[model samples]
Target: MKTAVIYNSDLHFEHKQWESELAFWKDELKSFNNRLGELVTRWTDKDVLAQLEHYQNEFILHGNVIEDLQEAMEKHEMNISEHSNKLGDTMDVPMFSTHKEIREKMETQRQIYADLKKDFFRFLSKYM
Candidate 1:
């Protein structure tokens, strides 16, 4: 089966930064799964199943480390804008050109992220 993908020059440049985050999220997810299995085996509390379900649902998004990095990248845009504005205020720089390019790139990334969400949720629901 084919899969949706997200990519950008910024993403490529920050791949190493995201790698650690991805590893951490995956490790946490595996730990959660292990704990869930233990909870299932114990059959000690009635609410355990509900808690497990909640955790499973939560982990679905938590496992999306790329989303986290994308968010950080987005925040960086604000800083870039501020710095650029400072420069523009002090000197004559066509800020619009840079802003326009970044905006277009961001919009494209957002679309890809949306597509990824759709595919992930669709596939997950099928198995769930």
Candidate 2:
């Protein structure tokens, strides 16, 4: 029996791709929530003088976490633009260099953001 041969079944590759994408999105949401927390503090003035309530009101008027996330990403993207494809390259990795590395770095950054958000919310909650 003669049968055509496929070079790459590539099931492993597909599985890995799926896993990475899943992780990226999960972390992405976490990061957005973190930025939103930051925005809340800014909007509310750290809950001083009942600022948290005003922030909650602002949230009702304009509920867009995506903007907050983009605002956060902008600083990171600027750093990438500043360093990427410029005069000299350093050993330090650029955040936007590659898809995999970008995601990895973004995840790390987002984890930090998330932790900060958790702590901020913990303190903020005490007031409310």
Candidate 3:
């Protein structure tokens, strides 16, 4: 019983961390968009313009992905809250698996974002 409580507590902490991370990434995306805007006025080459457009679209898509992940986390948290309210500190088995799935999704997003940053930096180095 004590261990279950600890496990659930850890899961809650992870969810909070993920929420914080997503928020940070969202802000970073805004900064990226602003940098792209700056690049737009300085560069008139068709290829540079095309790359900028691609990045703009990528940022938008990533923003949407972050939003969807946030919604999923919120729903998961709500489900856990509702379950605990009805049944004490014990969590449902499915909740554990669901948490695992969310963790994987977060990891995947982090990797993808890292790659995007690398590519964006390389682009800036070449063109800026």
Candidate 4:
């Protein structure tokens, strides 16, 4: 079996990168919401309006998910900082596990967001 080790600086860097990415996605969601509002003014067909509502609802759900993830990441960063302060730069194996879990969550969220963007663009092509 192989062992995986994560250093303090590595975790800090990862947390910073994730924070930046989540913030960017949050802003993008706001822009997408505005675009949906514009679509509302442009089209009134029942089917088109229904699709617009669907995207609007999706943006809201994603915004909530992003907020939750951001909170989780912030907590993780605080924990890491506390650990480093109390125990120096060395981290235990369990810390590596926590990092792995957060990394997986981040990857999953990124993939879902990418898929949603693609689908939204397809919908826009069809309607706008």
> TM-score winner among the candidates?
4
| lDDT, candidate 3, at 1 | 38
Write model 3 residue lDDT over 8-125, tens digit each, in one string. 6577889999999999999999999999999999999999999999999999999999999999999988888887788776667888889889999999999999999999989888
lDDT values, one for every candidate: 0.52, 0.45, 0.89, 0.88
Off by over 4 Å in 3: 1-6
| Candidate 4 residue lDDT tens string, 16-122 | 99989999999999889888988999998999999999999889889898888888888888888999999887678888788889899899989999999999999
All candidates in order of TM-score, best leading: 4, 3, 1, 2
- Candidate 2 lands at a TM-score of 0.29
User: Would you estimate the TM-scores of all the predictions?
Assistant: 0.39, 0.29, 0.92, 0.93
The per-residue C-alpha lDDT of model 4 at residue 7 equals 80
How well does candidate 4 score on lDDT at residue 35? 87
Candidate 1, overall lDDT? 0.52
By lDDT, the best candidate is: 3
Per-residue lDDT tens digits for candidate 2, residues 43-87, read: 545445355444344433222333434444445445544654563
| Model 3 quality (TM-score) | 0.92
TM-score of 4: 0.93
List residue ranges in candidate 4 displaced over 4 A.
1-4
Instruction: Give one digit per residue, the lDDT tens place, for model 1 in 35-118.
Output: 666656765655656655765675665556446555655565555546545653221234334434545654564465456446
